[model samples]
Target chain A: MIEIQNLTKKYGQIVAVDNLNFTVERGEILGFLGPNGAGKSTTMNMITGYLPSTEGTVKVSGYDIAQEPNEVKKRIGYLPENPPLYTDLTVDEYLSFVSELKKVERSKREQQISDIMELLKITDVRKRLIRNLSKGYKQRVGFAQALIGNPEVLILDEPTVGLDPNQILEVRNVIKDLRKEHTIVFSTHIMQEVSAVCERIVIINKGKIVAVDTPENLSKAITKNSRFTIKIAGVKASVIGALKAIDGVKNVEVSDKVEEDVYEYIVDSDKQVDVRKPIFFAMAKLGFPILETKEEELGLEEIFRELTTKNIVVSTESDNSKQDASGEAPEEDDQAEEKEVE
Target chain B: MLSVYKKELRTYFYSPLAYVLSGIFVLVFGIYFLTQTMSKAGQGIAQIVFGGQLFFASFWLVMLIPILTMRVFAEERKNGTEVLLMTSPISVPQIVIGKFLAAFTVFLTMTALTAIFPIIISISGDLVISNTLSSYLGFVLLGASFVAFGLFTSSITESQIIAAVLGTVTLFFILLIDQLKTLVSGIFLKIINQLSLYEHYKQFVQSVISLKDIVFFVSLTGMFLVLVMIVIEKRRWSQG
Candidate 1:
């Protein structure tokens, strides 16, 4: 279990983490969500006893980080943003060193190391130098290092940042399995990873907590206006005019033709309106058959954008457009993989 | 502490640092031994073991100590391994002492290799065993102090080259203090002479084991190690 109270970190005049108060219970996986420079990593660094908080106290497993650092540190395992690896060492040597440093019992050290290596799937590269490993392997090695001592808490920063889709899924499943035994707090900008693995989500922006809730509740709470993308097999003008004439319809935007006769239109509806029934009846009367009609549910992506960028309209528009163009769900995973390859 | 000491000692052999440092050490000490032996001729093995040769070998320590210790902490910080070290269950003093002893062990091994010179002298001629033992004791104490200073330097800087330079310059000044005493007089001269690192070695070179000199070298080594601990403590606060 972990508790942070009125925690703050300042560098000169700038505050990196400002008055953050959150608690993570035992065996619960908490996803830390934020944009770049949102102090997600800073908060994690403070929680793990890696960086001392300037203003407040962090208590882990009933030990204060400032007053009893070694005891608190003994309970937490941290994988910093950049894995702290000695490239000159082979995988076995590096992990052995880590095991020793963490004071893992000598009798069980070999067993623990092998078990972690097998779990992360880095056993084949155990004898190779860490410097020669690919980015994904290096990330797993970092993960293995954090698991050496079997600490009660695991704090991972961007655990799946550079892995391919398969590797990401493997890491995700491994983390999901780990949740039964360890309290996990992992930070990431990727939205789907949070929804897939975390039990509770803490959304942070600009060194402050914006919202904290379950993923389903978060999406439902932030969505005010409902929009539907409806594809109709008819002329665009009559369909748009008819949909606009519906009472609950707020606005209509029609897209260019995909085929000769099929067209796409986005219909905006006021809150608590069942425009689907009205639009279906109106288009039915107009003889414009609806090809596809589905209500759009807000994903974590839209929720994140809405929470983080409350001031800049243009940038939020561009962010949404970029997300839409690339089909935001899988694009980040592919981009991180591509960057790793290059 | 034992685990960290073991890992550091093993790490030296895994890289070329330990071997390269020993190679340079043997080459330099070998040259000094042969030259001093040839010059002394038939004056006996005491001259070969306790005279100018041992004193001159201490000079090689200026270069050797820096090379051996420059990478101890600086390299760890650069590779980000310091995070792994600092966040572990071990305290800062344990880490520092572990690294310091490892470097000192390397220094002792190099000195042990040079012991063949005394053995050869004893076989071919009369050798004073007590004289050689005291001289070796003095050499160990001197090396301990130098290693401590170099380790302290390494802790304050992230760049190994800077650590090496700072260590060499600090040792160079300590070495120069013996000669600088000749230019002053009265109490000032006595104080400057007392500050010389080589001054404490004179009793051992004269085949006399004095308690004051032994305590001086030991306390000096302890003082530097304490300074290193303080620096590391300050780093923890400043890093926040």
Candidate 2:
């Protein structure tokens, strides 16, 4: 439903988004995963017609963003990192105003609002002023505003930020329910959110698209080297010597010495080798016993770090992190939440 | 536009900024009306209404322009609601127009309170109905133009104080250009004088509703509203 090409947003010397190209298919929930200052929100802003790209074209539902912003706007419900809300207006009044602004049919505006308030579990706070409502409720109200016209595409920027665990799950489930009808793209730093709601994942770093694939594939691709963490009750010197003798083990490094009797080590295995079994067998042969051993399967987080930490992908010549200043942006970007209001 | 109008009207009451502003307006509008009507040196009721719109009524717009305009795009940028509207199906023009009308509605309420001035005046002297109506119409158009200017200033900055200051400066210059206009003679001075808001405001005092004056007010409103639209467009491009 959305196609962004050569999209670059520059603030004078600093480029926020650089020569980015990606397409989000209709009915797919695309998770935009990036570290802080990865241009995820900038890309989202350009896509939703909130901010204009310095260069590049964004087409929403086949309409060019620059040429037909209103039509594109009609199709999108955008919740920025901070929910744009009028604190003074009651939740009912705020949603009603949004409904009218979105040009929802006069007769159905109330019904649509009621349904959304119910779906987002905000029925109780409907009558209260938005200022008095809690952050989560304000977010839901922001979501209600986005849903006012029932747009075909929903572009949410950090939708689940600042919520309690329960509220996060509630918001996630609501988004899952929304996927049946609308094309959804949400940007977030949360790893579980991407795995939970998105069918496709786009990992961005330094204002560029680093990799785009299914979450499973991205996780699997970055974790080819299997490392096992084994804690053995023995002298560190003997355990190190015994570990070096194992055939499947390519290299072993002492990760930490957890206790006086226990030595914690990370053992690397070359290509699909079942080194855990060998390590247990080897430790058994020696007087030292295997206290605890587990194959440390890397989570999505490691995969994300591998992709965003700089210069991980070697084969492709897509101009991504080359132009960026690298790592200097994270501190400034910690205020991503605050910058939304600026 | 209706949504904007309603929200803006509610903002005045909710923030009590409107009540405070209306209180100021009534004080000035009432004092002026009383001095003219109670003079009974036999100043016409039409004269008071006409004269009130000419000089004093617009002061309400002047002071109000800052408060009403301060929060337009600037506060949205502050609170982050500009994204909500910009990302919606609303066009730049619509955003500008909606906000302008909303502030204008607040201005309208302030002016409406001053309606009591004319009513109180009619109790003392002859009230020519057509002239009183023309004066009110002139006030509406002029108030609208100032609101448009205020909206334009708001769109240029995220700081409300900056927006308010820019609005005051822009309005003050427009109101006081007659002396400055003389530096550049003849046609230039005439054009500059005509461009002055207070200059056009004088036409309402004599009961003249010339098409030229109407065109000037309408063009002023349109031009400022268009400028606001352009400012918002450029801002999004720069920051989005």
Among all candidates shown, the one with the greatest lDDT: 1
Q: Which stretches in model 2 have alpha-carbon errors above 4 Å?
A: A229-243, A252-266, A272-294, A314-341, B40-54, B179-189
Alpha carbon deviation, residue A138, candidate 2 (Å): 1.8
TM-score of 2: 0.86
Q: In lDDT terms, how accurate is model 1?
A: 0.82
Sorted into a CAPRI-style docking class, model 1 comes out as medium
Off by over 4 Å in 1: A233-235, A256-262, A284-291, A311-342, B42-51
lDDT of 2 by residue, A1-342 (tens): 888788987776667777777778888899998887778888888888778778989998899998988889889888888899999999999999899888899999889999999998999998899999888888888888877789999988889887899999999998998998999999888898988899988887767677777777676667767788888998888888888888867888988888897888988877567777777877788878887877776787878888788555521323333433333433233343334334
Please provide, for model 1 over A216-238, each residue's C-alpha lDDT reduced to its tens digit, 9 standing for 90 to 100: 87776777778899999988778
Residue A130, model 1, lDDT: 95
Model 1, B1-240: lDDT tens per residue?
Answer: 888788788878888888888888878878877777776785643444544567678888998899889988888777767777777888989988998889899888888888877887887766777888888888889999999999989989999999999999989988888887778899988897677778888778777789988998999999989999898777655563
True contacts kept of 2: 0.81
Which 10-residue window in model 2 chain A sums to the lowest lDDT? A314-323
